[model samples]
Target chain A: MILLLACVLWCVAFRCHEWLQSRNRTTFPMPVRAVWLNQGVRALAPCLALALCLMHSPALGVLFWLGLGSVCGVCTSVLMAVLKNKRGRAPAGKPPL
Target chain B: MRDTLRVHMGWLHSWLGFLAGLLLLCIFASGTLAVFDTEITHWMQPEVPLHTRTALTPAALNAAAQAVEASERQGFSTFLSLPSHRDPVLRVLHYDGYEFTGPALSPETGTSFAPRETAGGQFFYNFHFSLRGGDHPGVQLVTFLGLCLLVTLGSGLVIHLKALWPDLVLLRPFGPRPRAWVDAHLIAGVLFLPFILFMAYTGTAIHARVLLPAQSFFSPSPAGPPKKSAPKGRLLQAGPPLPPLAPLITQGRERLHSPDGNLVLFTADDVRIFRSDASGPFLTRDHADFSRKDGHFLRSVTRSSPTVATMQLVRGLHYARYAPLTLRWLYFLSGLAATALAGSGLVVFLMKRRRSSGENAFFRLAEALTLTVITGFPIATLGLFWANRCLPVALTGRIMAEIDLFFTLWTLFAIHALLLCLRRHAAAAWRQHLYCLALAGGMLPLVDLLSGSHPWGDGAMLFVTVDALAFLSGLIALFAAQHLRRPAT
Candidate 1:
């Protein structure tokens, strides 16, 4: 769950407009403070997740976090691609489905 | 200069990746399956009652010891494995050249029951490391392949460094076939980089002794005592009775500072109690030895030296015996991702060359070999399971028969692929193989439901899980086959 949140925060901080647009949502250009806040949270969420995992058990916790984090990141990316293609909204330069 | 370097690196990545990727696919796939070897073994032996959480009784241990002694009398060097959460039966096992095989004793009754002989998942475990070719040649080859994988990964990174992060999450499954394959190769390779790197490095390091033998710094002096010769044959002799194992286990656990003792190895003179691999992430063979005749504690051996401990840690990470259920599943997924990365790289290589090399005999053979390695292996694996169900349980040489069937199926698939490629119908071969995989995988659950031993019994969940995964694989193969029906963009 924490990893999922981290992925979401990352997508938002990176301004994944294609994903957002496909979901009938929009995130207009943010103010400087908002942009920084989004980026900060995006970076911090993974660290927080790591901390929580480490609190469980130091060695195995690190391994678990890395493996789970990789899977979640890929799943998030695949989800974005699927959503964008579903709505027939390929990015400007990329080929359409 | 940068363009030239990138081009050179790309050449290295493509050729080496194609050459080594085939064997690496087998290694990764088998290693992934080996992660669940115990569960698969359990599933294979349906005669064994499920949920048999009977406590490890002293009688059971003694019974297992007796079994070990008997096997020794018959010229087999064996050890006793104590019951654990994963396998709740005392097992007396010996290396049968390919895997450990022996009788399993009931924890409650201290009596033996026959579980039909099959290679079980240990086949995968053995194939993962040795390719079932034994220590000298097979391990050496695998270690070499591991080095090749490392080099290929490095060159690949060099070729893609500029776009690494920018395209980290980019995948276009609906794009042109070659583009989709490249995207898949990149995404899987990048996302699972840590896992594949760790596995490759640790796996190679574990077998360093085979690849780079250590030299002795000091030679034996003429003054040194003569080396003792190995004992003469006493296959029929029983030297000593084993001391009661329960107390020794407790003492060994205390000595090792571990909560559980998992293995007891017996010799003519002494018994050694080993700490369970499940006890921690460091798979130390921390064992406490005791005199067999008197049950007196002799000495405790722990790999406390920095070098040995580091090696143990490396082995532990690769083996992952200490991983919990969830973490193990994570390992499984990561391993599959790594396999996909290799498979996609192979496909991309083929697709990129197809137009230019379509008429080349060697290129056609390469396509055939790729089909055999990627799809043929899974087909054989599924066929092995099916054979396990179909073969009569009481037949002699049943284990050999099952193994032979697995190889036969693989060989037949390779032949089929070769023939089709010779006829210049390699694409049809792909679709046909995928359809076969789909049929086999899709019907696996149904076959189990019909012929499985007590499918709805105590261990129903394990059966269900295996069936579901097979069914899911079948569905994916079906999807891939359907995708192949469309013309190439």
Candidate 2:
């Protein structure tokens, strides 16, 4: 239980730092916001999966957590890619006539 | 100087990676091996016979320790470790007063065993942290290197951010020098940055605990009054000699519940401490439990502990103690990637310099470091393993001597690289360096066999493993060297 809490705390601390750094930047896109939300959910997923495993079976919980973490990594990568591509595709600000 | 988070972090990553890249390479590579330290130890001690017994009883182990203690005056404060079924020897470790620290195993009767110096296991351990030097000298130097790595990793992160999203998933194997370095660094760092960060923080934390204890949040325990470095005169009337260690063996076997636990005896007038552990759910070699230092058969906690469970947990996590096989391998591969990242980062600096400085003094210095560090440390490490296999048992101060051989050869390699780099065909000199590395690595195993060390022996696995690894890594170096042609003037 303590370990789970510790992990949560560590993730929050790291995310908080990132958020603070990004606060003054241009407003984040909707996908980036969704990605951030998913990261928050993902942070607690390990502990939740572990609890579920204890309530159910260890094998199930472990597989679930692994899947969860892998998905989170993949999703974050994808979101970052999409946001970058969207920015690249938008027309540049018009030059003075 | 950009205010953007990505820009700053990218900058931080580059500088940190650049500075600490080489040393971190050694740390991660050597640390990956440290995961198998005990297995390697077993492979190194060919003389110890494997045990047939599946389990050991604590009482029997204590009894054996008692018996051994009755005859020997100095080895009494020993821990009786239950033998693994895979190997048939009972291990007794005496640390209080011995020329060196090691296990004495009873292969036949499971009673008294002789002491011998084993440096191969320790070499890997030290090499991970200190490069075979003592804590103060070696670890301090490495930590300084680690600080540099921290800076490099930070800066590298910043530089990668501009194209990070587009290039993050890219794993281009063939590219120009900078492109390759960037890809290698980004892929490895992004994939394993969490691992590297944790490792760095924990490593620095551990070093701080040892070298800068004043910085520790928890102060040392005040219970056991600090003793003088050298013991003073005779308020210390020694106790009566311990009874035959055979009885303690019986005691340990009963308590430990395994038949394989061997008693290591220490003889003295006083202070007989018997330690043993149980076999059920025995911790794997990678689990870094403090209590396990006494082996599974010994569960008794000491009175004055310095570090807390939280501290231990962080340390264990950093060491990948609880990682399963798949994760362990993943960690190992990530470590190797980090090493390549570091090595390539250093090479990037050199490759960039060749164009800017050409044949000037500035270029020459960069070229020298590239040769010396890029090749020096690995050669020194391989040489140390070779010494462990070939050195005679009777050699005095063998451990220290083995370390000395590592430095001596490393220095020579550095000088050789320096001289070679200055030759007319500097590029060809690299090819030749790779050739020498391959030759030396190839001959190591043959040298071991010639010196009477058998690779297949029960305790001789490290000699073979290290030898094989050297040869394999050398082959990679050979391949890399072939790809390099003279830079277009």
Candidate 3:
């Protein structure tokens, strides 16, 4: 259950990081304060997850955080890509090939 | 200057990644499977009843000790392995060139059962590092490939350094085929960078001695002299009876501060009680040696030196023997991701070159090889399980037969792939192999059910887990095959 929580936190962190990027600003269309908030969450969530994990054992906690972080990152990336595709066609009105 | 550097790095990454990705696929896949080796072995040997919560008896240990002694008297070095949670049957095992093979003894009683000999999961464990080739050449090749993977990863990171962070979560599965492949390669590579780098470095460092013969780094002290071959046509005299192990086990566990002391290695001079690899994060060879004649505790040897501890940590990281179930699953998933990283790189390599060199013979061969590796290995792996079920239980030398079937199936797939490629039907080969893989994986559970060898009682979970994973693999393969039916973008 703690691993699950850590994984979800990692996913949120990755998503926030994705949204805060300058290149994604046009697509995300967030307010400046909201962007700042996302950046804070992106930084704080991972640290919170790491702390939660370290409550277990330092060695295993670190391993779990890294492994879960990578897997959750991939999941978030794939999920975002799917959502982006469903939102519309590619840029310039071109359909996805 | 930066453009030129990127160009050079891109070329190196592409060519080196393609060359090493082929064998690395097999290594990573097999290594992933090896994480569950004991469970897989349990699945393979359904005849051995799972003795969950069964306490280890002195009789069982002595019986296994006797078996080990018998094998040693016959000049084969063997060890007595105590029952553990993952594997509840005490075993007397000897290295049969490829894997440990022996009789399983009841943990409660001293009765021994002859489980049908199959390669079992140890085949994957051995093949992961040794490639089933002996230590020298196989370890050398794998070590070299590990270096290549490191270099390729370095170059790839350099090429993508600019976009690494911003494109961290960029994947477009519905985009152009080439674009999608690129996204997949980059995403998987970047997300799995830590795991891939850790595994490659630790794995290569563990075998660095093979690459550099002059440097001796933390070699463990041998229990005794090197083993001698068994004498032919000679009746060997039995050695002295082993002392009761129950008390010794208690003493050893107390001394080592490890309740998981699960292996008792017998040498001509003494018996060493070794802490289980699952005991902790350190793969320490800390053991208590006892005199063979009297079973009196001689000395406890613990590798506490900084250098030895560091090496053990490296090995433990790579082997993951210390991981719990959840962590083990994480290792397995991360390993699969690494395999996918290599596999996607292979696909991208082929796809990128297909338009320009589709007519070239070398390109065709590369496609055939890639198909053989990516699809062929899973097919053979599933076939091994099939062979375990289909082969007669009473047949002699069935272990060899099972291994033969594994290789034979892979070779035949290679031939099938080559023929398809020669006929300019490389895409068809991919579809066909995926279908075959789907069939092999989808039907594994049914085959296990029908074989009647599976234990549906105490140990059914192991069998169920293997079947479920195989079926899941089949579903993925089936999906891939159906996806391939669409025209190429």
Highest TM-score: give the candidate number.
Answer: 3
User: Clash totals for all models, in order?
Assistant: 0, 92, 0
In terms of DockQ, which candidate is strongest?
3
Error of 2 at B230 (Å): 4.9
Cα deviation at B335, candidate 1, in Å, is: 0.6
lDDT on C-alpha atoms for all candidate structures: 0.83, 0.54, 0.87
lDDT of 3 by residue, B200-270 (tens): 99999999889987646677767999876554322234446677878888888888877753788766567
Over B1-489, each residue of candidate 2 has an lDDT whose tens digit, in order, gives 466766566455545654566567677767867766555555456555443453444445455545444424442344444464433556655442212245554644555444335655545666788864556678887777766666666666665657554443443333244655555556566656666766777777667645555655586667877765423111222234344444444444454343443333322322223332222222211111111122223332323233554465456655654454444555665566666667777776666556667678656655666676667776776777677777786678776777789789878877776676665355766676767677667777777677664435444444566667767877877776766654432
CAPRI-style grade of the A/B interface in model 3: acceptable
How do all the candidates rank in terms of TM-score, highest first?
Answer: 3, 1, 2
Each prediction's Cα RMSD?
A: 3.6, 9.7, 3.7
Give the Å error, residue B166, model 2.
3.9
Lowest summed lDDT across 10 adjacent residues in model 2 chain B is found at B284-293
Deviating ranges (above 4 Å) for candidate 3: A89-97, B215-239
Q: Estimate each model's TM-score.
A: 0.92, 0.66, 0.94
The local distance difference test score of model 2 is 0.54
lDDT tens digits by residue: candidate 3, A31-83: 98998899899989999999988886677898998888989998998888777
